[model samples]
Target: MKKLFILSLLVLASCSPKELTEQERWEKHAENTEIIRDDFGVPHIYGKTDADAVFGLLYAQAEDDFNRVERNYIWAIGRLAEVEGEKSLYSDLRARLYMTEDEAKENFEKSPEWLQKLCVAFADGLNYYLETHPEVKPKLITHFEPWMTMYFSEGSIGGDIERVSTRKIKDFYEPNNQLAVSQGLIRTSDNEPRGSNGFAIAGSKTKSGNAMLLINPHTSFFFRGEVHMVSEEGLNAYGAVTWGQFFVYQGFNEKTGWMHTSTGTDIIDEFEETIVKDGSKTSYKYGDEIRPMDSIEVSLKYKSGDDFKEKSFMTYRTHHGPITHANGDKWVTTALMWSPVKALEQSFTRTKKSNHKEFYEMMDIRTNSSNNTVYADADGTIAYYHGNFIPKRDVAFDYTKPVDGSNPKTDWQGLHALEDNILVLNPPNGWIQNCNSTPFTSALEYSPKKEEYPAYMHSFPENYRGIHAIPLLTEATDLTLDSLIDLAYDPYLPGAEVLITGLLEAAKVAPVETNVAKEAIELLKKWDFKVSESSVGMTLAQFYINTYYRSGKIPNMVGNKRISRLGRFEYMSKTASPTERLAIFQQSLEQLKEDFGSWKTAWGEFNRYQRNDGEIEQDFDDAKPSIPVGMASSSWGALASFGTRFGKDTKRQYGTSGNSFVAVVEFGDKVKAKSMLAGGQSGDVNSPHFSDQSQRYADKQFKDVAFYREDVLKRAKSTYHPGEKNK
Candidate 1:
């Protein structure tokens, strides 16, 4: 009997599939890749092929900040609830609603051979990092899979998935499943708008007769890492890459530079579905037929003390998409673009394109749904694409509200062609700028005409930054790299100009009786509208705006006015009551005096930049060392935005976002550029790179980029393979 059992075991063992171990595959990949660290700690990865280059890029990213890399994947996949608790379960469900693990695997299997190889390399690179560093333990996801890449294909800070409200999902999927009351559609002002600034200057506007591009992304500090990726197969791109992503999200190659700004295009819409119930069966009305709704069971695990517990939910979906919540009597489903395979292909292939024609060919894929592209190349061409992946719809129905899903007319009619998009090619104005504003104002007189396109194409309003950039770019000629950098960091705040003029006029008509208020108004009247570390006027103006926003004075003055920050400022200047304006200003003075014992505090005393540790969510300390930043927020129309918010248990407002990774590139005979990061490259507190760039960031100083092989070698600080340790 023992001999027979042994024979059966041996047969089972031999019949199992055999393959190389993860370490063995990693060693093979490492042989084809090399990583070089420059003086500023930027990784310049060289590989024999594109897949090999991605392998080195991910490995280098892990070396810099493995915590962020792991955290990004944990949140991207539907596993955040397992680590964070029950409150995050709705967020996990939102991710699962768009794509399931099985669907992701199917997408991976259907990809082309070349892309499949890159996905394999992406997984292998992170798995190898774990094998090499046993000390770093992940919160979840012990083993990375190639299919997991599908969840995070396009590298926007927060993709379209974030637009779906988690609270709505929670209200719909809870145990009671009670219907929520309908709140009238209201577009509230975002506390800190998450957007970017992109500018493309043609050769006709430059001193060197070369097209120049500015890539400034105002994101959460340290959200992305600076990387330089190279391959023997004609792939060399340098820019900021979101952590855990394989592509350089916003960057440029030697021949061309590309910058992406968040667009105002209406790509995602909500549909009102008429749900039908027959006993236990559920159906949704689509056109003339009633189709059965798709139902799936989702099981989620959450941490309770030291043990793990699980919960199960039955989620419903329709042809439009998932039923997230109920609107009045109808179930509302969200519809957005979700093409993981094509998006990944377009993202990776765009890095290899060298000229305008090639870049245009890549745009034909139309998988990028959330951003606008500003392009400049060595061929002396400059172009602007308002939005990629626009879906064609009937002009009669309003897309901003929930459309009837039962109506066949509500269905999307294929995608709009590239020629049909809002595009500007070689504008006579010699420059293009988009600050997440309407493309109709991208170029002064050379901007695209809104009358020619359908109403659903765009609905973005003019912002303070766009108003600030038009005059600067229109008059800009004989521009050099230094002048462009200076222009980008210009300290003047146009939003402040409008509000201060109102305050001065109000003080003249209804002068405040308090001495402090009189002194504050006098100081503001003599100001130049420029922000600096020592500028007391900026400090006073920021407090004044904060007080007005919190005091609800503007709404009282204008009768429930809901508008953009700039629009609010314009109303305050031209229409607001003088008594209300004086009262708001007096409140700002009183609050400032109470907080700091004086209303004459400098901007530097309250606004600062600090990073004390390597934690993903940093804690700021008033007692710790911090650098004073001179820039203000984009809400105030400062192009070099340094936005801030109050920290925990502290009086000083510490900066947590804005001006993260900034670069200026000139596509001349050779690609000459200068770039700066908010902090250094590494996330470890003990590493020298943790806070090396903090002073440079505060001073608005930039370092020259090492693009050529000779330049990189000359500035190389360390070089190694994937498995090697730095000495």
Candidate 2:
């Protein structure tokens, strides 16, 4: 542990440059002709030439945090060793198998003309910045290859993570190991966030009769939103792209807009490879046949600082993928069959698509990464697509765990035809949304059945976010844009009134007899679920939920696998666990009593987004940075949600990370949307814009997203080409 800490320190210390005074000039070849600098410092790059816009965007990103940019690049280039020394060496080795410089060069050659041109233009932008910012030290390869970005894209946020950390392959068996495994499971939630919130109140359901479409997607802060990079030759788009990716990963176009969240559709699998070494030949036997296997040895090298002399190496891999340790007697190497090229092609094509016909045309290309797409258009059509490029496989065995690679049955059959996947359009409910919930509940009674697809698809069942979202949407009527904004800011306690009612009802007697403890229980008993800034009951409830609620099987299965609101109310009605419950009850009572002297305080007060340091307080602080708002109650949401605490005044509190970016696209009319991010655009700490949007984001507000060329220029504050002087 000490060694690990020391290694981290050295890696961080390495960032300090001895020659920090150097400056290089950035040469701009692309045209620069737009203004972009909102109050939040978001760079709205506009250009007569799409390449010019992209060049400026890249340069702007570099200016913010070249370190992260470099880090992303380092991983992409399989050069982790250059930063973290021996510990990261193995990860680099695994990356090398598929993304070597030579391979990237070859792939670049075969790439489509449009993609190739974008790659070159993007690469040149990075190079131009490197030329200008000489003092900013870079380790390993300073220049980036377009394909390197493609390599890092292969990882699963929650998939391979469960296979032990890269450094402690040997520690996979230790009883002491406590690294969080929930992240991987989170990636495989009951419903992966594939579907976006999409539904239209047609003329029949609306009093205005204009027809309303909701294009809401709960996705990663940077994953689903980014500006498009297109040239007059063919590229023209404007919206958000997944951070670190070159293409406009997903966003709105002129005629339509779309958003994506996680869906339950499963596309990745793990296969346990069996190795057999012959006298001089290396091969593996599957069933009755012995096939020659390729051996890939990755020796990673790392140096913390400029002393380049200090380096370490680690090893990982198999013919399938990286060999990861699960525990004693088990070595698992996962095979991920994602079609990145196809996905990218599909993404580029889909953004420019005009309608369902054009959209279906792109669907035939089958370049989808994992996500559920919700689309809305000016044409009064809204659709939900539970789509993924999933490989078909035999379902007799579980694919979530490692399967015997030697078994021919485990091999992936061809992919399922797109039409086989789950999809619903124009349901009677007239509105549909997926806050990472099951597909069955996407609409009224027309939801797709699980029995229709093979088990290998590995999609999620119903999850919590969708659970709460359904009720909220159903409760509202004549929904307008303001109502949607209010829904996004709903601060209801997790499990809301249901769990509280269940707990209250389940209790046999007050867990604590003391006046203070009794008061806390009574406060909870007679309480509302709203998490308004002043509710103290919400604070107590949130803390209790945060402490106890987690991912696991429910004890009682009257109807479902989850604890029902009635069940919660019943349990809490009379405290059951005397000692344990007493301690918790006492603790909760004391904390609330001590802080505000009463439990009646609104949740927003105590559970505030501490606006300390001006803005760092906005993103919530879950123990694990990865699982931002993964509460079981789904108060915040499955894919995105925020947490905040109110100060003494109840208004001066802090807001933390939640849904960072939001977009709603209408197919042909205009993009109606709200977007927020944790930090302002600039990475420069002192810049006001750095954290300017923290309050607005916490306040559930968004600046207008300049999507069209004219809207951006009309609202331009200041813009120029990459490397162009300030004007």
* TM-score, every prediction: 0.95, 0.79
Deviating ranges (above 4 Å) for candidate 1: 1-21, 175-190, 556-562
- Candidate 2, residue 552: how far the Cα is off, in Å: 12
Residue pairs in candidate 1 whose N, alpha carbon or C atoms collide under 3 angstroms: none
Candidate 2 stretches greater than 4 Å from native: 1-28, 32-35, 48-50, 138-141, 153-236, 304-322, 326-331, 475-477, 506-511, 549-583, 591-602, 610-640, 643-656, 665-668
TM-score of 1: 0.95
lDDT of each: 0.87, 0.54
Question: What value of lDDT does candidate 1 attain over all alpha carbons?
Answer: 0.87
Candidate 1 per-residue lDDT over residues 1-727, each given as its tens digit: 9999999999999999787686777988899998999999999999998888898999899889988888788778877777776667777788888887788899999999999888988999998888888998887877889999998898887688888887788887784645342221111122577788999999889999999999998888888999999998888999999998888988999999999988888899889999899999999898889999999888878677788888888888887888888887798999888999999999989888899999999999998998999999999999999989899998899898899998989988889999899999999889999998899999888899989998777877889889899889988889998999999998999999988899899988985878888888888989999999999999889988888889765543334544666667876676778888888888888888888889999999989999988776667789898989999999888898887777678778887777899999999779999999998899988888898899999998899999998999999999999989863
* Best-performing candidate as measured by TM-score: 1
Residue 424 error for model 2, in Å? 1.5
| lDDT of model 1, residue 330 | 93
| Candidate 2: tens digits of C-alpha lDDT, residues 77-183 | 66665765545554554455444566567776787876765565566667777777788776555786566545544222322223334444434323254433222
